[model samples]
Each structure stands twice: as structure tokens, then as C-alpha cells.
Target chain A: MFGLETGFGEFFTNYQYPVMIIIGLTLIYLGIAKKMEPLLLVPIGLGVILVNLPWPGEGLMAYEVLNSSTGLLETIPYQDYVQPPYNMAGGEPVGLMSRIFHYGLSWEIMPPLIFLGLGALTDFGPVIANPKTLLLGAGAQFGVYFAMIVAFGLGAAGLGWFDFQMGEAASIGIIGGADGPTTIFVTNRLAPTILGATAVAAYSYMALVPIIQPPIIKLFTSKKQRQIYMKPQLRAVSNREKIIFPLMATIIIILLVPASAPLVGSFMLGNLLLVSGVTDRLSITAGGGFMNVLTILLGVAVGAQMSGFIFLQQKTLGIFALGLVAFMAATAFGVILAQIMNLFSKTKINPMIGAAGVSAVPMASRVVQRMGQKENPRNFLLMHAMGPNIAGVIGTAVAAGVFISMIG
Target chain B: MAEEIIEAPMVGKIIEVMAKVGEKIAEGDVVCTLESMKMENPLVSPIDGTVKEIKVAAGDTVQAGAEIAVIE
Candidate 1:
């Protein structure tokens, strides 16, 4: 229903549409030109602008649509009025993105779906080949605690000016783990209040991986260690072993901490598709169009919620700053753990791959391989990096569960 | 025995082919190159074998774990 503006006739008369256009264009450029996390960030940035532009008495650039059965008008969020008089007379309780957020991520639903995609894409062979990497993943989780303690101490010392108790701070810190679904899972459970902030931090840091991880990696590892060559392990793992892994993991993790079942269960579902090989079609759906659609809705909806009023607060900035430190701490701890393991073993380890223990999966592994190739072109770290890469996923999920259980 | 196929492990336009059909090669020898996520990954043969067939050649787009050639 088109309703009359009772007041503020002059306030919104001046349309600052240029700002929204520029912001949207900038994000598009970053996503396309700079090759940032184009899949998610680009959509999110565009969504931010899409919702910001003041639509003309309508929900952000949307037109009214008729409901097939009821023949009712569905006004957009930018719609001046959702309902006027008739039988029901209130506004559409929530806007477009708000409704999406409420429906998708609010109940910790979207994350499990994302995890299903992640599991389908992941290869657990390396992890099964080398179980020791599991310890390194556990070690990398130190960052979550480091950030948690630091956050608590900051709040106590009046440093953050951000409103966060230990529980909320712990959720924010797990972004350093670099596993998006688990981050969503943990944050949703521990601090649903800061879902938007925590999600932005998790994804932003995940995108900045190449930028944030390299310096931390170089700062810690010596050239000698960097130059260490890793002999590729070509041992053929049987399909039986690969298939059993996710199953066993699901049981072990869920039995130990039922809180992690969503993360673990979704992951296993995806892995089962790949290992079983009968669901190639299902795998494609999860790994392709399904993931992309959900990612767009989820990212845009999350971005819309992060308006200036909430994002510009001092606490948000502190959380961002703390997130970087926490990531570095986790990366360093992962490497040190590998080094400790190497000292006791006869076979030498490529410590560079240790950085992948933060659980960014392919990206973290790629960073290790890049550094390895930089020093020794012949050394292929993908097989080796996969060891910790996958182990990190499980470790982070478990850690997320522990944090949520303790805090919530 | 059936030959095993060596695949390009990343998605990218194939940059080069170091081996040809019927060429004798060892394990760890690069068979082809591919670019993905702004990086290159070489398709390598894990077992010492003779090149039997080349499924893809230079300048072709290949995806992760896609068969590029066969080694026997």
C-alpha cells in the first residue's frame, strides 16, 4: 500500500545515492579486479549498497509482486508501507535482508549447509595418511584462547570499549581458526548478538589470508626451515580407509562433544558424497549452485545488518584488531607444534605446511605450497599440507564446540 | 594392465607439456602446467611409467583433478 509521509518531508528529499553507487562499485572492483573473495565479499559489498540507497517509497529497488494463491501485494522493504488498514495493519515485521538473516543464519542453519559444501570439496586422504597432523591442528587452536583471554583482560582494563563478556569474546576469537562454517556455528551458539560482526571478521580474515599469513609465516620460520624439502608421500590409500574416516570422526567428535555434531555431521555428509562416489550429482549441487546461492544470500544479509550505527562502534574496531593478532598467534603456534613433533621423529617435516593447521583448507595449504615453491621449486606441499589442512578443520570444529559448551 | 591417468591438480589454462605420448618418464616429472587461484600446479606422474596418451595439450583449460594424460 502506498502511504503518505506524515512527516520528514524535507529530511529524505536530498538523495545521497552517489555514495551507495560508489561503495557498490568499489566492492565490485575489488571482487573482480583485485580477485578478493569474489564469491562472498563481492555480493556482501553490493548488498550493503543495495540496501543503503533510499528507494522511492518502496523496499530497496523492488517492485510489488502478487501472491499466487491469495493475490496479495508483496511490497519490498523499501516499500513505504507494508500494510495499511484492511484485516492486518502493521508493517512487514522485517525487511528483505532482515528476513533472510532471521530465516537462514539466525537458527544456526546456514552454517551446517555451508559445512556440507565444504565437506564435499574437502579430501580427507592426507589427514588419514598422517594422523599426527591432528595434533598440529589442536595446537593451532591456541589463538582462540589467546584472543579470549586478551579480550577478557581488555574488557576488564577498559581497553576495548566494546561490550563483550568472556563468552562473546571467545566466539569472536575463533575466527582465527579460519573455518567459516565452524565460525558461524560457534558464533551463532555463543554470541548470536554479534553474529554480523563475528561473521565479517571471520570472512574478512579468511580473505586476507594471503596477506595476513605470509608475514607471520616469514617472521617465524628460518630460511633453513623454509628451504627444507618435503618428499612427496605417494602411498596409495585404499577407498575403504577414506570412506571410514569421516564416519569414525563423526562418532568420535559427537560422542566426545555433542555440541560439534552440526559442524561434524555436515562435514561428514559432504565427505560421504565424495567417498561413496554414487552422489556425484549431489556433490555437484552442494559444491556448486547450492553453495553459491546460499553464500550470496548469507553474505548479503550479514552485510545489510552491519550498518554504520553498529559497525562504526569502538568495539567492532577492537574486535577487528584483535582478530589479526589472534590469527598470527594461531599460525605461529601451529608451526611450533610441528617443530616439536619433528624433533622426536626421524623423518624430516616441512614446517611451512604447519601454517595450514589454521584450517582455511585449500587457501592455507596453497600458502604453504607457495612458500615452499618460493624456496625450493621442486618441493610439492599440497599432499603434505593437506595433512594439517584437513586436520585443522576437525580440530577447529571441536574447539568451536568446546568454546560454545564452556561459554554458553 | 590398464594405465593410470595423471590429472592436472588445479584449474587453469594449460601452460606447457613436458611429456609427449610414448615418451619414457619417471615419477615426479611434470607432465603439464595449470593455473588456478593465481597459482600454478604441475600435473605429476606418481609411478615411474611410459607416457601412453596425452588427453590434453598446451593452452587448454583444465580443472582440479582432471585427467591430462595417461601413464603406463
Candidate 2:
């Protein structure tokens, strides 16, 4: 008879397990009550609890093997777990979440698909109207390189607190990109072991963009600078220009960085679907129900990766701290670059819009809009900020490609 | 009196209609709030006048340059 042991023993023995469950509950509470990235956080929080639950047999992340001697199913080491296509005759059972993670994330399918959805949903008109803002977006990537250097310094040969290899350092630094799918895509390739921590850090910081960016924006800009008004009317982008943008961008970016082809290619294809006008049905499906389904799966799979054994480490704390640094540095660089641009340009730009270059999409731009209104009620920075906001997405993706090519 | 057409500045769904036909409004008064890219953008009247026509209703998705209202 297969006996089920009460989870109480394991809960008491491994303190980390219960702690992780509490963290999971906290995330759920934040998602529901506080409404912070609820779509992704809620699923991830539930996944954390599910994976942490104590089971008498192989756990949610374990492999079940048939014990010929005892005529019972027994848990096998993760290293020895069988890959997909289990033989039912042999009674091999794979952990459900583990299988999802392997197929969705480990197989490198989900992130690109998510990018396709995001691309389809995005509007590049703002960037098209103000091409110079692309420079601000590229400037924000300085945070990635800055954090990578810091990570390398922390893991120096002798004084290293954590033994981070080249791939691990690159993965950790990409969290500064503040783009979740990009972080996941790069981390999965370079350092799968730290994917859970890096992904969580990326999403959490992104949700906190409103809180995180303002202080840095204020630190870098004066009241006068924040109040600088941009003309409300951007030159209307023609339909022909919109249609050509994605195609042109894909060719240029891929030609420059071949490693970025997967992410950039998927993103441009999605955008092409949206702007082509003739592909309205395909665009709608790509950005609608199909995207929603992937979001849920990606959220759950990422959450499931937060097992206590893998997540509750000193290095995990380091990743979080460094992620904050990356975000702050990215914001600072964007603002500084804008101030520099103003010194030479005829038309003045609100330095605050540069903070939108952090690639959190509408959230970062929203922060700029809010701050701008506070300074000058007539000031509408939303459309103007969006220029760099969308550009940041491309900037982060390109940076991820750079990292992959160099180290991955 | 010159008639002014108020166009939606961006593609989005009209979440709220703040002005009605025959209602007097100021140039900067918000005529409708458009939700685009998950951000709420208030579309304001360009010229102070009576709302001559309301071309959109709540939940109506409007494209950029679509006529939202007419003021005179």
C-alpha cells in the first residue's frame, strides 16, 4: 500500500519550505489586493505554493520511477529523471510543472511566442515620429553593461562572494533590461539555473517601475527640466511608413547581431502582422486569446521554478540587489543622455521622458506622464515619452542579443 | 461661428464620454477619455464651444484621426 505522509514533518524540518510558502502567499496578496502585475504574479504565486507543498511520493518537480523490487512508484533524483515521451508501460511519471517548464521554457519556445504577442500589440508610431529618441533607448542599455561589470567584480576570482561564471553574470545583468521575456530568453540560454531568480527580479522591478523610476528621475533632473514641455502634435506617420518599419528594423538589427535574430525576428513579425492592415485577423488572434493563453502558461512555469532549494540562497539575494542597481542605473543613464541631447538640439526635451527608456512599456511612460502633469498641468508627455518607451523594447532585445553572442 | 471637429489623437477605446451634444465646454475640457495601451488619455476639446455632435459612445473603439466630436 502506498502511504501518504503528512506534510507537517517536512514543513518543520526544512524551514525554507514554509518560508517560501509564506512568500508565495505574500505575492498572491500583492497581486490580488495591491494589484501589482496581478496577471503574472497571481499565477506565479500559486505555482510557488503548489511546488512547495509536501508530498509523500515524488514531488511536483520530481520524477517517479517504478520500483521493481517493492512493486511501488518511487521518486528518483532529478538528474536521472526521464525526458518527455514517458513509457506508460514502464510506469514513468514526470512532475507536471517540471514537464511544463521543460517544454515551454527549456525548449526556448515561450519567450519568442510572448514576444510575438507583444510585438503585435505594440504601436511604433511614437518612435517613427521621433527617430532621435531611439538614441535614448540605446543609451538605457548602459545599465546592462554597467551591472554586468559590477557582477563580474563581485564574482572576482579571490574576493568572490558568489562563484558567478560568464554566462551567470550576463544573465543576472540582463535583469536590468526590465523586459521580462527578454530576460527569460537570455537567462534560459546562458544560465538556466538562475532563471527563476532573474525572471522574478525582472517582473517585480518592472511592476515597481512607478515607484522605482521617479526617485531616480528626480535625482537626475531639476524641476525646470521636468516641466519642459514637448509639442503635443507629432507629425502623423503615414500607413506606408508604419508598414515598412518592422521589416526594415528586422533586417537591420539581424544583420548587425545575428544572435538577436530569434527574438527580434519574432517581435518584428508580430508587428508586421499588426501594421499590414491586410492581416487583421492574424493580428487580432496573435495579440488576443493566443497571447493570453501564453501569458498564463509562462507565468505559471516561471513561478514553478521558484522551488525553495533553488531560490533561497545568498546568491538569489545578490541577484535582487543587483537588479535594483541595474534599474536605477538604466534610468539615470537615460535621463542624463536626454539632458545631453538638449544641450545641442533646437527643441528641448523633458529629461523625464528619458526614464521611459527602461522598457517597462506603458508603465515607464505613464510614470513620465504623471510626473510631467505634476510639474505642469498642461504638459502631456505620454505620446512623447512613448517614443523612447517602445524604443526601449528594441534596445533591450538587442542588448540581450549582444550578451548571447558574446558569452552564450 | 467656426465649426471645429475633434478627432481622436490615438487608437483606443472610449471609456467615458464627458461631454454631450449641446453642452458648453472649454477648449481644454476633457470631452472623452480614451484608453490606449492600458493608459487612460483624456481627449480634450480644441476650441471652446457647444458640443454640436458626439460621434462616439462609451466602449467604442476609435482609430487615430476618427471624428470623436464636433464643437462650434
Candidate 3:
């Protein structure tokens, strides 16, 4: 019998494999035990582990190369693969995860599809009821540009510590929007190489919105500001208004930023399906099973991209640091804007609702609700915060469109 | 006594009903927890009163403006 040798020795040869595996396991634990973004994190964690594991044959992310001499296909590590149109003819992507990443992300199919699902699930009533909240959402985008300037400045300073191009800076800056799909959409277009880092940072920070947003909300606003209460009920929005919102928004946004058509169009289409009261079946599927499948594919593909060699780098650290700065700055700007708005408005607005402008959806709004409750139990700011919460989505999508138009 | 009806703030599932019929509750007291958009939102009482009627039970799906409970 032939002696079968286990590939255990590969761990010693490449220490990064073990380190990456541990990181993968930590993400899994956080997802399952802590219940933190389990839908995305679980698949991402598993993908990381799968790609980093020792394999005697071609790896999960291996690229296929056609060997002319032997007239056969040969597999090479993804990092070693060269861009197409320059490399030898007949070469193709062969790995399962690699193909998904290429088709779903590189071809720019997943993000828009994900937005469709999100749109079906979202209710634009809050934003329609309170139009001024749109400005608050726009205010949160200050962090995106602020971080971009800092990142560009650092890179231009000639400091060897960091080097980022305009596209890369834009990709990193979108992390401030606190919208996961937007970050992925922007990064996949602007800097595919940093997609894994930016996606992970965006999702992780989004999950940590409850923790990340409060300090900044409290730091800028005093107890009195935090306790400022608005009317408990907003003027009831009619279905007619709800139906008109998506159509008008799509037309207006697409006109302003043509590049945003894909993201905005898909989002509005989903919203139309939900509100039209005529596409129940399509709405259910878009927001349900279809979205789930896309999410799994997206999560795993993103995770597979985080190979030890690509993810374990000095640049990855810089991306994470810049992402944090983006989130903090976005929160601060939102709060400051609300405070400024109060100077002119008659009805008082809880400054904390401005923090929800980062578009973490219900999470950021929930943080505002909790902090509002802490300040005064009588304050029910969830619905009010939701105004800006939903607006953040549109705001981020517009910011992404601007980036793509200017730099993409 | 004036009757005050608590309405579901948003569309969601009634995860848990914390208030009982005829139970004395204070204004702002959480009467039930509504799970909407994957977030647990507590439906609080609008005025200090006794719970006159519980209109919905746990696991019931609700729509925005649906009456949740009637307090007197």
C-alpha cells in the first residue's frame, strides 16, 4: 500500500495560513455566539477557512492557465495570476469561489440585486413624512469625503506608511456611508483589490453601530439636546405618496447621477413592487429567498477573497483605520448638522436622530432610540430616527454615484 | 376615564405581550415588544391607565396603525 502523507507540514511552511484560520474562526464565533451579522459573517468566516486550508491540489481560488507545450490546463494561485488580454490565450478562472467572485462581483451583478431585495423590504414612509431628514442623511456623507481627503493627503505626503490612489481612496471613503452593499458596490468598481478589506471593515463597523455611534452622539450633544422631543406621530403618509416616492426619486436621482442608475434603479424597482400593491409575488421573492441566496454568494465570495497573502498586509490595516475614522466622522457630522438645524427650526429635533444618517438601517436608528430612552423614557425616537435612517441609504448610493462619475 | 388606544408603530410581529388586561400601567411603560426589521421595538403606553383590552397576542403580525391595546 502506498503511504498517504497528510499535508500538515504546510501549516509550518506558511504561518499566515494558521493566522488566517484563527481569524476566520473568530468571525464564526462572533456570528453564531454573539449573533452579530450572522447571515453574512458566517458564510464569510467559512469561506476564509476554506480558502486558507492546506490543499495538495489546486486551491479554491486558483486561476486556470492553458499550457501550450502540454496542451493542458494548469492551475496557479490567484495572487500569481496576471490580468487578462495580456496573459496567454485560453486561460480562464476555474475555481468555484473564483468564478462566483468574477461573475457576481467583478461583473457587477450582486450589489444591485442585493439592493433590490433591500428596497422591497424598506419603507420610505419615514422619509416621505419628514423631508428635512434627507438633509441629515446628506450631512452624514461628510465623513466619506473627509476620510477621502485624509487618506489622499496621507498617501500624497510620500509617507511609506500608506499609499492610496484616487480610486482606492474613494473606495475606502465610502465605508463612512455605513451601507454594506454600497461599500461593496463602490469598492468592487473602484478598487477590486481592496474589496475584501473594505467589505469586512464596513460590515464589522455596521454591526458595531450600537457601540460606535453612542459616544460620538453623547460627546457632541448635551443631556438637554439629547432629550429634545419631537411630536410622537408624524403626519400619516398616504399610499399615493408612498407609490409616488420611488418613481419620483428614481427619476430625480438618475437624472442627477446617471452612474447611480443601477443601484438607484434596482432599489426603486423593488420599492415599486412593494408599494404598487400589484407585485406581491415578485416582492416576496426579491425580499426573501432571492435576497438570501445572493447574500450567501456575496458573503462567501468576499470571504474567499481574503486569502492570507492578500488580507494580511500593512495596507489592510490602513484601510481598517481609515474606515473607523469615516464612521466616527459621519456620526459627528450628523449630530452637528441637527444641532445647527435646530437653530432655525421651530419644532425641536433630537440631535441623536442625526446619527442615524449613516444608514445602518434599523441598527443606527435603534441606537438613537436607546440613547433617547436613556435620556428620557417618554421619548419615542425610533420612527423619527427612521426618517434619516432610510435616507442614509439614498444618500450613500448618491455618494457612490458621485465617486464613480468622478473617479471610476 | 378616557380611552386611549395604542397603535402598532410599524409593521412587524408581536414577539411578546408584556401588559395584561385590566393591569395598571404607567405612561411610557412597555406594553409589548414588536419585532420589526429585525429590531425589537417596545410598544409603550401613551397614558397612565389600566389595560382595558389586549387586542393582539404574541406571534401575531401587525401593520402600522393597527390597534394593539385599548387603555382606559
- Compose the digit string of candidate 3's lDDT tens values, residues B1-72: 899998876678999999999899999899999887777778788799999999999999998778999999
Q: Which ten contiguous residues of candidate 3 chain A have the minimum total lDDT?
A: A82-91
> Which candidate comes out best when scored by TM-score?
3
Q: Candidate 1 lDDT, tens digit per residue, A60-149?
A: 323344444475766544222222322223323255665676568766788888889988888887777788878888888887788878
Q: DockQ, per-model, please?
A: 0.10, 0.22, 0.34
Docking class of 1: incorrect
What overall lDDT goes with each candidate model?
0.74, 0.85, 0.88
Error (Å) of candidate 2 at residue A281 is: 1.8
Worst 10 residues of 1 chain A by lDDT: A79-88
Between candidates 1 and 3, name the one with more favorable lDDT: 3
Question: Which 10-residue window in model 2 chain A sums to the lowest lDDT?
Answer: A79-88
TM-scores, each model vs. reference: 0.79, 0.85, 0.90
Give the runs in model 1 whose Cα sits over 4 Å from its true position: A1-25, A53-93, A160-163, B1-14, B18-38, B42-72
Once fitted onto the true fold, the runs of candidate 3 whose alpha carbons sit more than 4 angstroms away are A1-6, A54-58, A65-74, A82-91, B1-8, B11-35, B42-72
